[model samples]
Each structure stands twice: as C-alpha cells, then as structure tokens.
Target chain A: MTRHMSESDSDRSPDAAGRSWHDMGGLPAGGINPAEHDFALWEKRVDALQVLCATKGLYTVDGLRRALEEMGPQAFESMTYYERWISAVTKNLLETGVFTTEELNARMEAVAARGATYGDASIEGASPEGET
Target chain B: MTSLPHVDPPAFPPPYPSAAPRFAPGDAVRVATGHAPGHIRTPWYLRGRVGRVERICGDFANPEELAFHRSGLPPRALYRVRFTMKEIWGERAERGEDTLDAEIFEHWLEAAEG
Candidate 1:
C-alpha cells in the first residue's frame, strides 16, 4: 500500500506549534484501522441526546461541528469520538444557559456517589426493591 | 402530548444572473490562505496549495455562515478540486499516483497565476 501522509519527526503531541487539531491532513496516523464495531451504551446515549437537540432546533449540525472544532486541541486528541460529541453538546448547552455549571457538577457528583453504592435502595433503580 | 418539530436545512438563495461562474474545469486555481476567525469548511492542508478544477459541483449554502445558525445567503459555488499527493505532502508521499479530491467553496479558491 502507498503511504502519502507522514508527520514530522518533531513531538507528536497535539496542539503543537503550527498545527491545529483539525489539520490532521498529512500527519502520520500510524495507519488507518479498518476495524469497526457497534456503538457502546454511552455512545448510543450521546447520539440520542445529539439527535434530540437537533430535533428541537436547539443547534444545527454545522453549529455542533464548529463547537467540536473549537475544542482545546489536547482535549480533542484525548477524547473518543462520542466523548467529543458529549463534550461539544454540553459546552453548547452551558453557553446557551440551559443549565448552570454548578448544577451540572452537582448532578454528576450525585450520580457518581450513587454508582459507588451499587445496591443502595434510596437511589431509584439502584436495587430491585426500589424498582418495585 | 408533543409532536416532533419539523426542521429544514437552510435554503439556497436564488441564483443571480449577474454573478456568472468564475473558474472552469481544467483551470488552475490556488486555494486561499490566511488566518480566518470562526468556523470554516475548507481543509487546512489545502490552503495556499495549487490545484486544478475537476468540475463545478454547483452552488450551495455557505457552511461558514450556517455554523452560526444563520441562513447562508448568496449561495457560494462549490467545486471539486483535484490535487496530487506530492503537491499536498511535498516529498512525503511514497507513491506518485496518489491524489486527493475535495469539494471546496469558491470563496476559498483563486485563479492560479502563471
């Protein structure tokens, strides 16, 4: 197979001088991985939320793409595809004042705490008894 | 009870006869270069590179404006630009037959000066 794209010998770190995250043009990507797989649970959730936002006319496809493009290069490089999607969606929501940062953080903390106590009945859906 | 909202993509502006197509197929053109603020659809690698117009792909709503949720007016012409791998990657390409074709908007291209 022919290899046309190759990165320089300099640091391969993202957001390096002279290259933005979106400018992956000729940069070496090791090699294209042809493997494909079904979306994970979280990935599906991200996609559903994005579709919901679009359906509600809360944001356009271009708007979401632009938001993804503007992400910090390091964060963009480190995040998985769906992770980036959720990040962009959350950023848009915050910018539009759909919810405050404090509220988001507190909700995340609550979910984390609930997850720690797997069988805690006080949290709905945490135990079979709670389900009833 | 609620129904799904009907949303349509941005509409294309009616064509103006006064604005004729600029570049033609086989015409040498250079992709525009320089810093631009806000969202842009043009790829960074193609910027400032010279290529040939493969064909006119027709005018469409400008994605740059659409990024901000505005109706892209005065639709921009879209063209398929063909570039050799060497032209884009310099001496980095392993094979000479490699090439890339991208659909670029008219605003991002200029007539290549001989």
Candidate 2:
C-alpha cells in the first residue's frame, strides 16, 4: 500500500503475492452481515477446553492462535470456527506433553467405537465397551 | 511416598521485568515489515504503513515468544496506533477520514519520517 512495499507485493495478485495467507485486511471479499448465533454444545465444550487449558498454565491463548495458523488456509476455509479451535487446542495439549500420540489415538478409537453419532457417544458411560 | 498421578506440571511463563516505553502519545511511527512466521498479533495489512501513536496501552508480555512456550521476558510497551483508511487502501478507501486502530507491541514500530 506504500512505496516501502516490496515488488512482490505490488506486482502479483494479492493471492499469489508473497503474502501471509491470513493477512487479508484490505483484500476484496464478501459483504459483512453481522448476525447472532446460538452456541452448539460441542462448540461450548471447545471454548471451555481452551479456557481450562489456559487457566491451568498448559498454554497461553497466543499458543492456541499459533496452532490455528499452523492448520493452513485449506483448514481455514473448510473447518467451522470452533472446529478449528478444538483442533488447535488439542494440538497444543499434545505439544505440551500433556498426553502422548498413542494415548490420544487409542482414546479416539475408543470414542469412535461408542456410537454412530456424537450424541449417542456423549452419553456418559453409555458405550458398551469393545462393541466394535 | 509413591509419585502422584493425574496432576499436570504447570507450564507457567517465567516472570520478566518490563521494558520502558520508547515512544510517547502523539508520536509518529511506522509498523515494521516483519515477515517472520509464527503466531503474530500484528496484521499483514499494516506492514510498512505509517501511523500516529494515539495512546500508550501499557506493557504486556510478548505474544510471539509466549506462543512458543517461551517466557516472554522483558515485557514490551504496547501502543494503540491510529491509521487513516486512505493510508491503508489508497484511493479505494470509502472515506479517507475514517481510521483504524491497532494495538502493536513496541518492537513492531519505528520512528516515522516524511
């Protein structure tokens, strides 16, 4: 936007320019129509996880932002906001040595075996262990 | 006693003595064109843009370092810099008079010159 900008920034289309993927402040995009939304139970859980993790000194909020940025632009375009957040939070927890990869994968498998839908799986202790 | 379980060792950031403010309110400054990759609080659009220091937002832990689990020691001064829409969008600005404010850490700023 100024003379100080590099030729790469001025020469190419904003998308192709050597620009940080997340830096789209002045780029042409869709109209903004602000709207209120009711939080889903899962989304609230994600939020709570972030807050709890921060309070526990496991990671800073900035650490969570780093994880989100690391997910890349494809994930940004595809994943819902809270979905990205949960993914990021999970990653930071893993990085901090809170749990091992094998532990996480095994837990994920156990959870997946619980039921076909998230709602069915969420019912505490409802899983018929090793049904799969 | 046997080692306890279920308690996670806290990863708290080490306390850092704060740095003094370099620029004062109403001083002119420019945002640094920092391209380092990591979790950055400064937005890309504001890079190389010149603005006026609207106010001092006090010192805070450096988020860039904090993001990597490092102690953000020697806290930096935070400032609310004000930029005109025209400066950011050129002639495409809907109104040149409109302004945007960003909270920037001291390290991202430099003395502005004509």
Candidate 3:
C-alpha cells in the first residue's frame, strides 16, 4: 500500500527517526475505514481474555498498553486492534514466565490438530461463574 | 484487597500529598521533551509544542509510574491541553480548522519559555 506522505513530510519532523510506534499524529492516516463498530468473534474473545486477566489481578491496563507499545514497528503497523491486544497479552505472560514460548506453540499446534475437540470436554467446567 | 503474595497491588494511590497545581486554565505551557522507558501517556507529537491549558481535569495517579506497578505517588494534575493541528503537524496539517485536545499531566508540561 502506498503511504500518502508528501515530499516534505520527512523534513517536517527531523526527530521522527526516534519517534515511537504509538506516535502517529501527523502520519498519512489514509481515509478512515468507515466499517461499522463491530467486533469479530475472535476479537470478542481477545477482549474477554484481557478483561478476565485484569480482573483476576494478573496485570494492569497500563501494563498491557506498555507491552503493545513495545511491539516492533512492523508488527505494530500490521496487526489489527485485537490482534495487537492478544499479542501484547501473550508477550506479557511469556515475559513474566507464567508460561513458556514452547508451551504456547505446542498448545497452538495441538488445538490446530484437534480442531473441534480441543476444548469441547472442558467447556462446561470452564464456563465462567453464573454464565450458565 | 486480598491478593496473591506475588501479585502487585492493583489499585494505585498517591504515595504522598501532591503539591498545588502550578498552572491554571488559559495558562500557556509547553510539553517537555523527554523520553523514558515503560508506559508513557505523553504523545510524542505534542512534545516541545506550546499550547494553552483548556482546564484542569484534576489530579489522578501518574499512569507512567503505574505502568511499572508502582504507586503513582503524588498524583500529577491532569490538564486538557488544546492545540491547533497546525501546531502539531506544522505545514503538513490538512486543514487549518482541525484541532486536537490531549490530556497531558503536569509533570510533562512546563511554563512556556517562548
């Protein structure tokens, strides 16, 4: 995709070289994609995980934001909102040694292989209190 | 609040009484230019930019400190700083009418030297 930057855009901010990923103030925002404010199923799951983890005292909102901000420029630019959230949450979990990279990869592989049966048996027990 | 021994306190309170806010509404100020690690709410675009304090939104726990799980002691006064898009984006601003309002904490601001 072509960036809508002007010829003098770079000269405007001499210090842009050191600016962080979250600094997108004057950059080419292209048109706002006017999609309705709708969350995909997986996006909803990501949001639920964030809220649940925070409620359980695992991490603070600020902590999660900091993790997202620390993401590499490419990943930060490429990810969707919920994708960034999940990536940051997972990074936090891994950094704190709550789980290892290997374990996460293995679980992903297992879920992919098992597909429909991955969490079927545990769904009843895993249902949050009072939800059923 | 009951919490696991390893878990940090979730609530952040001022570690000490904050000093009186230095500036008031309509006061001219400039965002300080500095970079530190961890969670910083100050947007880089506003750094070193001059703006007027629209209003004092009162004090709250310093989010920068809270990002590291520390008590945001002596909550910094939060201000709604108003700036024209031209001020932030210089000649690159698309429209002269476009404006931006950012919530900036006192620690990130200083009396406008200009």
Candidate 4:
C-alpha cells in the first residue's frame, strides 16, 4: 500500500504522534504499527486518570493539568485524547458533587507524594450521592 | 412601603413544545450514536448499558471549554444517569456496590423495562 500524505498530514505527522510513544523507546512500530500502540497506551492512560480523579476526587482543571503532567511524556503528547477523557470524567464528577476544586488539589498533592507513579488505579470508593 | 403603579407582568412567552419523555429516573437506555470525529462528552462504558437516569440536566453546553477545549457551544440537555457497575463491568461490581453515572445525550436514550 502506497503511503500518501494528505494536506493536513504536515500538521499531524507521525513525528508529532510519536512524541508520546517514543518515551517508551518506540514500541514495535515496524511490526505492530506505532500509531495503534500509541492509541492503546492513550486509552489506558485515560482509564488511569479517570480512577485518580474519581477516587482521589481530583476533578478541577488545575488538578487535571497536574495529573497530565504526572503522566509524563508518553501521555503528554497525546494531550488531545487526554483532554477528551478528562472532560468525560469531569462531567460525572460535577454531576455527582463528590469533591470540590480545593479538595481535588489537596488529593492530587497527597497522591503525588505517595509515589503512585504511572498506572491505572481502581475507582472503588464511596459513590457520591446526587446533589442539585 | 409605598404602593407602586400596577404594571402587567411581562407577557409570558409561549412554552416550547416539550419533547417526548422517553426514559425516566430508573429506566435502562443505550447510546444510539457511534463515536464521531470531533469532541464528545459521552464515555465508552455507557455505550450500550441499560442504566437508570438519575437527573435530567437540560440543554447542551460545551464541556471542553468548561474544562480545556475553550470552544464549541454549550452541550444540549444532558442527563446524569446511573448504571449498575455490573452492567458496565459485568461482575466487576461487588455485591451492593454497583452503580456509575453517565452524562448522556437526550437522543441517546430509549425506555427499557427492568
């Protein structure tokens, strides 16, 4: 199959896409297709951040920014995907009214100190009762 | 207090014809639309779940701008519905600990008898 670069290809190049995946030393791109690997990684990162937000109650914009930064380079370049994932999680957090911005920030700082590092965490905790 | 001149209340505007109420606070529903190319607030877990609506938040409001996208109109009336975590994870939810909230589009729901 001939690889044809589209008009927008210049803006969305593989190099741009690879910035995140490259942190893991270029996952089997030749054999397994790096873009697919990056997407999978991106999906997993989203799941991890969702748990962090729900359990730790880190649902503010600043809190999300901190979580993304903690995600390191691999999850950073896939920022667009990260934003979408957080938006979904934030909507739920707001609807449930579990934690406020101040509480979330404090939780983030505490989680950061625990050396939680990068990985998915379970959102197993008390469910927030509906308010408003 | 001095009495003011009586003024007729501003003419009430005609009420919009309400859309047919499909799902209620405890009805199962599923998303009819697939993942589009642009920004969307719906999550992957509630794509095909038979969950219950917890609250009906009216009208679309852009969630991205509220978070980070900083663009797009406010999302339409969003519904905060509850789904058994078991419905989403199938056995993942422990006994008596099974529920999740999904911010779903109004068009994405249909009544399902429990």
Point to the candidate with the largest TM-score.
2
C-alpha TM-scores of all predictions? 0.67, 0.79, 0.69, 0.36
- Per-model chain B TM-scores are 0.79, 0.82, 0.79, 0.59
State each model's CA lDDT, in order. Answer: 0.69, 0.75, 0.69, 0.49
**Model 1 — TM-score against the truth?**
0.67
Over A1-132, each residue of candidate 2 has an lDDT whose tens digit, in order, gives 344244424632476444667766667788876998977767877898889989999999889888887888899679999989989888998989999999999998998887767643343545678456
**Per-residue lDDT of candidate 1, residues B19-85 (tens digit):** 5568776677888864566787777777767777776777777888877767788888887777776
What does the interface RMSD come to for each candidate?
Answer: 13.3, 14.7, 13.2, 19.4
Sequence-dependent TM-score of model 3: 0.69
Flag regions of model 3 displaced more than 4 Å. Answer: A1-15, A36-40, A76-79, A95-113, A116-132, B1-19, B90-99
Report the C-alpha lDDT of model 2 over B12-86, residue by residue, as the tens digit: 421332357788666778888776777888887777777877767777889999898888977888887888776
Stretches > 4 Å off in candidate 2: A1-13, A16-18, A32-37, A118-132, B1-19
lDDT of 3 at A130: 46
Best by lDDT: 2
Better of 3 and 4 by DockQ: 3
Q: For candidate 2, give the lDDT of residue A7.
A: 41
Clashes of each: 0, 0, 1, 13
Q: What is residue A13's positional error in candidate 4, in angstroms? A: 26
lDDT of 4 by residue, A1-132 (tens): 011122222322335432232223212344643564334443676687777765664354434543343455655456566565665575557545666778878887887787754333333432456222
